[model samples]
Target: MAHYKAADSKREQFRRYLEKSGVLDTLTKALLLTSKDVVLVALYEEPEKPNSALDFLKHHLGASAPENPEIEALRLEVAEMKEKYEAVLEENKKLKTKLAQYEPPQEEKRDE
Candidate 1:
């Protein structure tokens, strides 16, 4: 009985030491890393089926989308808008270059 008690006391002391030294915290972190590893392994074992999600999206969108004629009109409008945007960007760049041309040139110093 006394030997058992001594062993129990040593066990408790070791437990306290582990707790005080942050061993338990480290052990918990290790367990969390292990759990993440397991999740990664599962993810790598089987690729995600992205097509299913895309199919779901297509099914939902196909129901609500406008007819082909309307889509064609929108495509033409987008093309026109893109052309206008490019024209504006070209005008902006030309204006910047023109402004730089109007700046006074630095005077060269003559050597004495």
Candidate 2:
């Protein structure tokens, strides 16, 4: 039937679109699959169906995944460094203030 052919044509067009846009390649790479077709089949046959396919892929691909231990450790180290930097800045400010008391105040330049 013409209707069946039209539906098949639409599906084929969609497949081509997916292929041309590199979605197939990206999905395959993210899932670490040797074959891109397997990515499509996996998504289609996922046992615990997710509400959003994009979210499901993102969750699996580390977008919303748990932080890696090394990365978490680096984050904490950065925070500690920032705290140290702030403390040093405050100490520098106090030292400058104390030095200012021991130094002569310069005369302000008056604009004529």
Candidate 3:
């Protein structure tokens, strides 16, 4: 069914996102740390629950998770760059419109 396929596709994308974010590896390591004080098998068993998984990981793994101050700085830089890029694009559009106003229109050619 199309619905099932779409759900499967979303699952695949989420799996890839988790893998790329290193969440999968961290969760695995945490789960393997069953010999330690924390019991992280809940992460594997209750992943279907809607909650802050990253927050959970950060709490248990401390600074080992992907998020940090350096990443936060990079994210802010990216957002600033995007804002500047949009502003430049708007200026470019306005300049092009002004230039078009000063130029004469060209006649279209006929195929006769």
Candidate 4:
């Protein structure tokens, strides 16, 4: 999910709102089309939960999948950081060695 841009991530929320609004209007139209004393009842009335079996499976299965794009992006970022860190450490070691070669030797003080 992190790999998705802010706009793409909000697509789901936008779609939900769109579907909800459409359903509300559609239901009113459908009710008008119905005959007298014919009550249209939904077994599951809540929009928060999945209305169909396919939606239910998709929700549960997608949660545990290993080949997620967001996880892969994080792994790549970590590897890039590790390479940069290692290169800096090597450069620091080389700089310290060069610095030591340019330094004057310490002179021992004689006892007065």
For each candidate in the order shown, give its overall lDDT on alpha carbons: 0.58, 0.69, 0.67, 0.54
Models 1 onward score TM values of 0.33, 0.53, 0.43, 0.37
Cα deviation of 107, candidate 3, in Å: 1.2
lDDT (Cα, tens digit) per residue for candidate 3, span 55-99: 556656564556788989999999999999999999999999999
TM-score of 4: 0.37
lDDT for each residue of candidate 1 in 4-107, tens digit (9 for 90 to 100):
99978966765565456554454455545654445334323434423233233234334346678988999999999999999999999999899878865545
Q: What TM-score number comes out for model 3? A: 0.43
What is candidate 4's lDDT per residue for 1-112, written digit by digit as tens? 5667775765566446436645434444443434211212221323464444334333433433567798899999999999999999999999999997887655522322
Error of 3 at 21 (Å): 21
Candidate 4 C-alpha error for residue 83, in Å: 0.6
In Å, residue 97's CA in model 4 sits off its true spot by 0.4
Off by over 4 Å in 1: 1-67, 104-112
Among all candidates shown, the one with the greatest TM-score: 2
* lDDT comparison, 3 vs 4, better candidate: 3
Q: At residue 101, give the lDDT of candidate 3.
A: 85
Segments of candidate 4 deviating more than 4 angstroms: 1-64, 108-112
Candidate 1 residue 15 Cα shift, in angstroms, is 60
